[model samples]
Target: MTTKRCTMPFLRACAALAGVALIAGCASAPEGAAPKNSNGWVKDEVSDSYVFAYPLVLMDVSREAATGNAPGQAASNTLRNAQSLPPVGASSPPEPNLDTLVSTGWLDLGNEPVLISLPDTHGRYMDARALDMWTNVLWSTATPANERVNGLKAQTIAFVPAGWKGTLPARVKRIDVSTRYAWFIARIQTRGGADLNAVRRLQRGLRVAPLAAWDAHGKRAAQAEAQSGAGLSGDPVETGAPAARVAALDANGYFNRLALALEDNAPVPDDQHALKILGDIGVHPGDGAQLPSGSKDMAMVNAGLADGRTRVATPPSNLLAGNGWLWIGDDAGNYGPDYSLRAYAAWASPGLPTSRDEVRARVAQDSDGHALNGANRYVIHFSAKQLPPVRGFWSITAYTTDGALDGDAPVRIAFGDRNGARRNRDGSIDVHVSAERARGGSNWVPAPKGDFRLVLRMYAPKPQATDGSWQPAAVERQ
Candidate 1:
């Protein structure tokens, strides 16, 4: 009989060969590959996946930052009130409006429904906007269709999670929220420093709490609890500020967080195609995603992230453009299934955006096609018949090129109907835009000492303003 020997080296070599073959088989591209120069199906899939997940990722990071454990920080079920307006040149929230005092809070609906109570505004302009995890406005008092009492009557609102069953007070309006977490922001109009006390009183009147807590302690006790900084529990997520958290995340971290968020906050039915695309790449709600291991797969995902970032920063063709001004269309806040548009809005402005009737127009250049700088004077002339059509009011405000309030501008940086602008003999209004104070007081909108832009706000705008029939006057250099 022949002696058969199995050497250690031969056994090791066989195992190594088998491993290589298995890896090669797993990495092989699918059949029917794309032609040359085309971003193959893998890259396309990666691109679509990033776009589909950007908003959710962004919101998750923001929620973690806002509710995480920290000193002087309110927990998920409490309110945090901003007693005064944001400082000039506050980059945290670009283009901070001087018109209102804002109070913000995060809601946790996992346990039970929450109650929101608003005091009578006495004809003052006040709004409470609640956003879901995806940044969609779940409910807003600013929307005419949803307004509770026209700023004249006290109101109570109960926010319940999907499939929640309970009997609510007949007087309390119920709003259904899809996600377990919700963000609330209340804005009360402030005339100036002199009117701050009144606004503070109004802010104090805004209350939020769990339905059971509110029912047990009552509205006054709930408000006192929120103010005392009590009853806030520790947050489970560990994260920093929203922007910092996003920057710290790698491809794996970002995708993992997105997967987890999707598990909690299910996507709308319209997003089935996107969900399928994600599944093909081993990413599914409630399942820990397994990313492809090949170098080419990593490269495609990184490239897709870059592409999505660019798309969000660039305005789409549907934006309203006229005389160097650009603004979103009538579909400002209520985005149904337009992922790109929704992602862009979340990236640019994180809070609940104003509705179509509240138009916000921006201008970056003068009529002569030059970048707007404080070195030169400019004028925006609106004929009597061409004035912005708005039932509420109109105003023009200036900000730095990066969207911060121009700190160099005077305290009264904005001017419009509230300023009681002076009109010329022909009934045309000439708005002076310059670093130096203009001759006329009411029609002057202060500009920064360097490059700046203008935002024209028209609240309760008419059809002409929204339908693109009425265009803002050109900014002509003097």
Candidate 2:
């Protein structure tokens, strides 16, 4: 007989009954301790907790918002395709790539394993990634090098919970996830909107279903999970808009969410240190923050939350910085225990591809160190040899400081080989950046009216790109 796992709600109720007195006693640095030392410890705890929970909260909020009954909202456990590029000034995500049609969905792994089937791409550039509740990439088609050999072949992936005992088909690959919830993002390359039909055809070939809903013939079983309402149920938690959900979280709310997420998504062995820190501050897994109300400790917790937000927004020292560009090296998407780097990257560039599949360089200033303003034109001159080397392609996209596209331009704003970028007589390419169309023609990426940032994305980048041997030319003010 299978034992039933304790649910998050039940665990939370038990924690609440344990009371604040019990929590305070468990704190390593309790109130009335050394004022200076206590403050420092509290601050560190807040930062660590915030970084640890950023991805979890972000995923939860996004999943909730997307699964709502609204017109544009996508139901959970189903894939939603973006047919075209995001409109100008859209807040969905910054630096929207014009190269691919995006497909996104969330997975519910509470009942049984979910099977993801992919069709052979036949040399087409495409990747599907599965990120756990904490934002760690559990599985991706872009990794392990050999997976990309001979282009993408039709494959079956079964994502099961950790320690699950089941008999998977011999052909289907098994991926064990420690979390009950997972997010899916698939990017299929396209030359432009004209190539969208081909991408959509490939998109239709992708399928996701519960293990019970899968048949021995590798097809979906009819009327299996449908009657049980197993895979299609929406999340019980009511969540607001993604940004709003994040903004509305207070110290208590944030820790409570973190605690709840931990109940189901057990941390890896590497996270023991972080978990210990959180527990000392009364934010144990499955239990809410138990700090006493109107206490000095409570006040300190609030201050730490604010500071943690700032740190996540600021770039850490390890980010590769040169020529006015900032980027994570080969460790872009798969951050192990580097919570600070992971949190910061997620804040700056959400849904980043793994470094093997793509590396992004972002700059807000020109070569001379002045902020890039659309009113002042600039040029990114790539000499014949300086062009980004990639097995797939590269593009330079512009975004506002807040990570939104320039509102003035209706057309997709980017310049690259796939677009109509022109080469100079000397085999160099000059990409013009400005609000006004450049006289250079065909190589112009329209910037916003004010200060903006530029992202240089090298898809399927060559080894040199990530090996510290190749870097793009500096952006020069005109």
Candidate 3:
């Protein structure tokens, strides 16, 4: 909660960015005299502003990569489904989900409400969530608090824009979004390679259309659209890791993109304070402002940008940390004015669901606080009473330190309830994690040949899982 202060030189630089010679602060302070906290305040404010604008900028760039100048691109409001899982060692979207097939799209909600229709999976596990441009969860099928259910029945949802007066069909549910754009993501459980066809069938049943094109029953009235295979097209756009791309932007490029994004995705009520800070730095809703280019000015802004990146990459104070694991559950997916938490979540993994939907924990160190490596064998023993509490399922997957699936492993492996892990006679489950196989090979998770990390996913987690009453055991070195 560091505060921002205005200084004479910074104001002059801001005025320069706005293409104005002098602003209100010019007469207040004498030229060539630094204010009481000029350097410190500017650094703090610049870093804070960068964190505030991180999610919006990242989302805009990802959307551009998804829908612009790509071969076989799917337009906005069209679903592009993944027919299979990401390839081994794939790292584009860091920490890729290995337990489900994903179908995603961008929605243009400016003109009219977009319709998303999903088919019944007959009790199979599936969930869909829509996030506004700020990365807030607008609606999620996994949240029972919202009266939504996952894949139990055929459901039709309409994503309507704010302040739009419209009457959707009687059976269609409506979700109002504050931004002109939204991202929709849906996932269905997959057992393994054998479960691809069934998941694909369900994926094909997922549909998206504009409200104007839908009939009374939520089906598109246009015959041609219905026959277009539900907007399934070529492979999904690969934008290499978005976090890396965002980190590479200089102050000019970063602030310019933030200004452009703010035009479509207006700030929320709590965001006004941060917006005011940004305004002091010459960044406005629609102005692509530039930073001063003098040696000292450039050095100051670059230092601020570097600090912001470090802050976003650091784990927040409220994270759940135990047994060498760090994970966030509370205030996730619906962050309000917690810009640091929100920005870090977006940097770690965009489109994170709320705690009720899922809770993910990651541990990169052993019980002794040593970095996990394949050279040392390890085992995770879960007592019967301490097993992950979840209504849907749970899984633990290994990845390289950089967050990619281990391609060099002998086989693709994950262990959890869905994978049929073996239990000891004493009612405990021991999962062997190593490059070499453990005895019997029934509950072995293939580790990378080098340093690695483990992610534990608890889908539809129970209350104890997030309330600190239950936690996964520490990984013990053998």
Candidate 4:
């Protein structure tokens, strides 16, 4: 005879968890919150109720973070309300043709540790970045390390991270993640362009403000939280050790404030509503003066007050950092292999190209001492005396959509000076990319079917390579 126990925690956790499943059912949700629901519940649960809900809490933040505002949204109005902003860093010089990648939302896992697992691309290890766009990461300690999985469709990936200590899989670098409550932010790293020197030079322009000041601000906010005591799951829930809880909330709050602050680059107006809400407890979306007094703004206010759906219940994605491994774009692209999964921490990166003109349209690198990605019909010709300036070694490779190495992968994959890649009579080297690499004979590297990416790695690069003096030829479709 078994007795069924009735419990409030159990019920709330179940409802909250079920809600999250609907949002980002893929990754792990708050520890115990899910009965099934996922994504949607997180943002709301956190925003409306501050109580700790498993997995959903993480899911909410990630969804919010990934759903970024359109660029230049609210530019005019924000400019009118603003004091000052950091100067725009030097924009890249116009390339023959530039492909711009706007910032998009990242996958969020609130408060749960997630592990991404993908095999080392048939052990090729190169070209992990291209696969990142279609990889799945698991949000559970139950999973293993530095691994990615597949759902047979290859669209969903199961990320396996063995422990909580690392950043991301050594093979996969960056992926956007945030909590509904998050305010802090992390951007994707830039690509390694042809001019290694210019890449390094461009990298120089980036800077970050200190966290100490942020800590002070967070402290103040936390103190305020203690006095007011917000609820969790829409019901008033008192925080234990109010001071500690407040500080934690403040840290998360500060991140919320930060995201709102950055809303106006080429700023569009559509995304402004969310940005305005960076607030004491929830996202406000109200700049007050700028909001139209006409019917629209009034309707907006009414919507927020009346429709529970209009309010953000989840914390921002940035807070999801602790729940699972978080990485940047460069890491995702495999520019720095094991950047997150491995013990990689540089004040900056070394893989950035030296010049803008010498950018590779796509590239890939692997831990198996190989580099791969889409060179589809496009070959980065390395003019001999100008071999890619990699200090450690180099290789060209190709992989499938989910970062798997394919036997029939197109192109000529080669790496290390040891391979008998024929140096032209003039000493110039040419890397030929084609769906049919075997036809090119010894120099060919095979590619998979469908869209692809590539990377050219030069470990221990030279002064010219790192200083913007040299540049790799861009990936050109033959």
* Local distance difference test values of all predictions, in order: 0.69, 0.72, 0.76, 0.28
Candidate 3 has an lDDT of: 0.76
Find the candidate with the highest lDDT and give its number: 3
**Candidate with the greatest TM-score versus the true structure:** 3
Model 1: CA > 4 A from native: 1-39, 143-150, 216-224, 228-248, 354-357, 410-412
What lDDT is reached at residue 114 by model 4?
27
Write the candidate numbers in order of decreasing TM-score. 3, 2, 1, 4
**Residue-level lDDT tens digits of model 4 in 342-439:** 11111111111222111222343322324333434545456765676643345554434433344343222333343557666787776666555445
Q: Rank the candidates by lDDT, best first.
A: 3, 2, 1, 4
User: Which ranges in model 4 have alpha carbons more than 4 Å from their true place?
Assistant: 1-277, 280-378, 400-404, 407-418, 476-478
Candidate 2 residue runs with Cα over 4 Å from true position: 1-40, 144-151, 222-244, 292-294
Cα shift from native, residue 134, model 2 (Å): 2.1
Q: Per-prediction TM-score, please?
A: 0.84, 0.85, 0.88, 0.28
* Root mean square deviation (Cα) for candidate 4: 24.5
Tell me each candidate's RMSD, in Å, in order: 14.5, 9.7, 7.6, 24.5
**TM-score attained by model 4:** 0.28
Score candidate 2 by TM-score against the native: 0.85
Higher-ranked by lDDT: 1 or 4: 1
- Deviation in Å, model 4, residue 459 alpha carbon: 1.8
- When summed lDDT is taken over every stretch of 10 residues in candidate 4, the lowest stretch is 75-84
Clashing pairs in 1: none
What are the per-residue Cα lDDT tens digits for candidate 3 across 144-207?
6323324457889999999989789778888999899998888888876778889888887888
